[model samples]
Target: MVGCDDQMERLLEDLTQYSGSSRERKFIRIIGMRGIGKTTLAKKVYNKADIRSHFDFRAWAIASSQHNVKKILISLLRSPKGDTFYIEDEADLADMVQKSLKGKRYLIVLDDIWSTKAWDDMRLCFSSENNGSRILLTTYNSEVACSVGTENLSL
Candidate 1:
């Protein structure tokens, strides 16, 4: 993180900012070329002590080129005991995630997201309740970053 102090600060501010009126779930997109510290920055922000304390639940999933919605959901919904809950249906898994996270402040990090379809699929697992939840996405594609309609941190 030699030259990433500024970007790290920006991400921390974005992650912690709040508005009294609208506590809707927000997306913080990190866009840059491959191997340009996108994932590294996201990891640093996600692992901060204050960040861990701020959210009721935090999950991390890697969405590489061959992203699978079910797999991603499993990663998000895994228990602290390292037990992987098995569910054959994707919708059922997604429902479990939503039900567990409903009305709670959560942080979901989708690292290495390669396509808009991946975001579309994973976003469904989260409820858009005004609980100040957030999704931190790291992608190498500008198009995928812009599709979320949020401010992107270009690394």
Candidate 2:
């Protein structure tokens, strides 16, 4: 939240824009070195009053270097509701995530991503059907940011 007003405003504008004109899903990548406030800014934007009301659902997931797909999916799925269920298969977990977010406009924040592979694996769970759904990610790697085809904020 320190000296991030401009960046925060830009991100909020991007996030709240109408995406109905296209079928592609929108992604925002916040990139910065460790000890910077990348995650802090994302959390502030994600929890804003306007941001909360703009989407039907909101989920926050932390992706560490290990990149466990199942664990990530489960964390995302459980965020909307406090449901506790065990799904041992990755495909099933992906399906559940897809189903839960199929027709709903959602705001999902993937924090601390280490690689593009993690983004690729998680991207499959989202459907791009003109739903104004957005995926916000924070990473330290420029390569991962570039792979996702989006301009990232370097802090």
Candidate 3:
């Protein structure tokens, strides 16, 4: 943690600024090896400061070695967001998630992603909304991080 505390803090600040910006979409992907605290950092950031004073809605999904977009989406949807649950397929779940996230500055965190396909499918749920909605994705693959970010992530 000490290795990049300042840098992480600065990045968090920049994201906070973007959260309030009346501009484009803001998507952030945080990647690192398993047990290296990517999930921990994402949780702390989402609950404490990252979503503070900015995000109108917040959702998190845990994608382990399995890829069940429907179940994950149902979990987040049925949370405090007041969304309903269903046994729909991935496409339907994705549509619900997208609708629930629309027009709101949301912080959608997908933790412990194991496959690129899961990210690809879930990405359909998020839209720019012009409210600077942010996506904080955590994975162990450098490619996944790079695919969703302008630069690679390491810790």
Candidate 4:
């Protein structure tokens, strides 16, 4: 973040800003080439003390080259006692995730997301409540970045 302090600050400000009655959840995408600091920057913002305190719940998931929506949903729905439901059904898992974060202001980091389809599958698990909840995504593909979010930081 040495050379990217300004970028980090901008992202932080965006995440903390108020969205006026936009019931739709907000997304902030971090985009850059491979080996660049896209994921690093996203992690920095995601782990910030103030940022952690700002949200009611937070979860980080990696959307690998072989992305699995069920696996991603499970990561989002994890509890202190671990898989409270322990079911194999994707729809049920997604419902659990939605139910858990329904009224809470959550911060979800989908790190290294590779495709729009991956986002499409997982987006259903989140609610469109106007509670200032946010999703921060990292990707190497500019098209994917643009398709998922209007607010983005290009590393």
RMSD of each: 1.3, 1.6, 2.6, 2.0
Model 2, global lDDT: 0.87
In candidate 3, position 6 carries an lDDT of 60
Model 3 alpha-carbon drift over 4 Å, by segment: 1-4, 19-22, 81-84, 151-153
Candidate with better lDDT, 2 vs 4:
2
In order of appearance, the predictions have TM-scores of 0.95, 0.94, 0.84, 0.91
Which pairs clash inside model 1? none
lDDT of 1 at 28: 90
lDDT of 1: 0.88
Residue ranges of candidate 4 with Cα displaced over 4 Å: 19-24, 79-85
Q: Which TM-score value belongs to model 2?
A: 0.94
**Model 3 lDDT, residue 110, Cα:** 80
Badly placed stretches (over 4 Å) of model 1 are: 79-81
Instruction: Provide the lDDT at 146 for model 4.
Output: 73
Q: What residue runs in model 2 are displaced by over 4 Å at the alpha carbon?
A: 19-23
Tens digits of per-residue lDDT, candidate 4, 14-120, equal 78787664645688898888889988888888889999899888888888788998888887777323654578999888888888898998889999889888988
Per-residue lDDT of candidate 3, residues 1-155 (tens digit): 54667646755764576434365667777777788878877776777753566778888888777878787788668765566665657777778778888888877778887777877867777887677667777889876776676423455
Residue 94 lDDT in candidate 3: 76
Ranking by lDDT: 1, 2, 4, 3
Error of 1 at 80 (Å): 4.6
